[model samples]
Target: MDTGVPLSVAVSVVGKRQNPELVRVAGAGKEKCCYFFWQGRNSTVSEKGTSALMTVELDEERGAQVQVQQGKEPPCFLQCFNGGMIVHSGRREEEEENAQNEWRLYCVRGEVPVEGHLLEVACHCSSLRSRASMILLSVNRAIIYLWHGCKAQPHTRDVGRTAACRIKEQ
Candidate 1:
């Protein structure tokens, strides 16, 4: 789970398979709101209407912080990185508005020693405001459209790449 750079993960198996030590994750005051979506066969989400993939609050608290215990899960050989985003507008409308886009708990990649089974880490957002499409975690009830595997190999090593030039999507 070295999201430091070489990240090309898309492990599946959600809802009851429960292993890898029970698995538990609930950070930042138990979370409140978070949304990041990018699953093909789209329905709608390209009109540039959403943004703020990761931003709990800031002054009120909860900026970005997720933790997952366990270890050993690195073998290299993972080339599926779809990192794209070029959002730039003005920034207003209450900072991309959010009345209840609720989905707390966004970003958790713990114990990824892939081989046979045990892997469920999903978070891919690029048009919610564009920019930073590598590890943008966030979810709640659960909603993963479809992100099979492979076809995103484009690395340069940036580390937490989330840059907003001016902003648009309004």
Candidate 2:
């Protein structure tokens, strides 16, 4: 989901398999219902109206990470569906601004691959604490918007909210 695009997109977990899918088509002005959680490979996401596809991969060096490929735009908003919390967020090798890239997210440990499903996002808790369902992730060229059906409260803003921290890759 690229911030450059004005279209509202979301990742929806439909049917069994709990497989995440991108929803782009809907009534005009209707926000796309979407939610996603990834800790490994083979994850599939699609763009609205186009055949373009994207994949989310976990980097052992980078805790709870989403590796967005070039020319791909992930959703800018994110929310947690089940039980989870994003601990510390690893800095992007491409971003060097310490002031802008503050370690806003932190917890007991650093990287928790096994707890991936329990931890929903990797952004400042201040934004998420705003509301229970407020848990969201901020993304850059590969922005990942997370939405949780069970935990998050309804946001007046469509498709949740943007995160304070943005992700970048080299």
Candidate 3:
């Protein structure tokens, strides 16, 4: 999957005559996975809120694979209902130096909620170990804030907790 895509948008799936409708909530630019919203009644409701009842096919694929650098930190804070694990990390000086543009690794698995809205956030870390170190930081400080649509900005003081670790591995 292409890493440039965002996976933070909400999408609605409509059922055709032969096909069932499905709703997809995913992060911007990332591949969306199919999540069954509501089962269909004998009759379909009007488009107003009826769109929420559309049935979806279980075989369909949605979000894309999030790409992270091997040995580098991820660029944005990652969130998913199911817990995720760190997979890789890397560094590219040629790329932008901001935290949002840095690279990292993660593997998330869980049932995404379809009640109100779903959101996926991307986070950046300066180093690999620190990236893992900041998992709790991303969850409590970043992910929670984004999920609730809260307004607090991330603090810069929290960035260097893992700085004492070695830079390069043998």
Candidate 4:
């Protein structure tokens, strides 16, 4: 979500995909029932409505092992909604700077000619390799480029097309 926009904007945008009644009531502000988890503390929608989107970095070695987190303070705020409740606090996780980039690259992996399997790669020329497929998204230019190395696997074109479609929908 763009911090430049108001929280109300989020409500409106979400209304496009959420329950009509919920969105309408929230917008009307008659009896606001917005609630969600923030950090590790309890938070409410009536709060200052200041938040930022951040990416929590996990160890590559451990892959994606879940860990319990206690409360801490001093970090950017982001409206986080994964599952369960919303808790608001001053706590912040590590920011994923790269996630903020308007340009993104994804390397297509797997040898089965999958339609959407991809591994996100840094948007650098060095990241391009000969044995795989890739997708490049340029939001500023409103363009999507698909590249396939000559020695790439069989599904590069299919995966690129499917992934590009998904990105467009997003």
Clashes of each: 12, 20, 36, 10
Order of candidate numbers by TM-score, starting with the best: 4, 2, 1, 3
Local distance difference test, each candidate: 0.24, 0.29, 0.26, 0.44
Model 3, which residues run further than 4 Å from truth? Answer: 1-60, 77-157, 161-170
Report the Cα lDDT for residue 109, model 2. Answer: 13
Query: What TM-score, to 2 decimals, does candidate 3 have?
Result: 0.17
- RMSD, model 2, all Cα superposed? 16.8
Candidate 4, residues 1-170, lDDT tens digits: the string is: 11111221122223243677776576743322222213223333332243322112212222222211213311111212111112211223323544366776777643333313455566899999987677787777788888888887666666556556666766
Q: Using Cα atoms with residue i matched to residue i, what is each candidate's TM-score against the true structure?
A: 0.17, 0.18, 0.17, 0.39
lDDT preference between candidates 2 and 3, better one: 2
Q: Rank the candidates by lDDT, best first.
A: 4, 2, 3, 1
Q: Tell me the TM-score of model 1.
A: 0.17
RMSD in Å for all candidates: 18.6, 16.8, 18.1, 15.2
In the range 31-114, model 3's lDDT, one tens digit per residue, is: 335332321222123531333322222224643233322222232322321123222222233234545643332322122211
- Scored against the true structure, residue 136 in model 4 reaches a CA lDDT of 81
Tell me the tens digit of each residue's lDDT in model 1 across 22-91: 4544212232421222221221243222222222222133222222112332232211222122121122
Q: If candidate 1 were superposed on the true structure by all CA atoms, what would the RMSD be?
A: 18.6
- In model 2, the Cα lDDT at residue 168 comes to 21
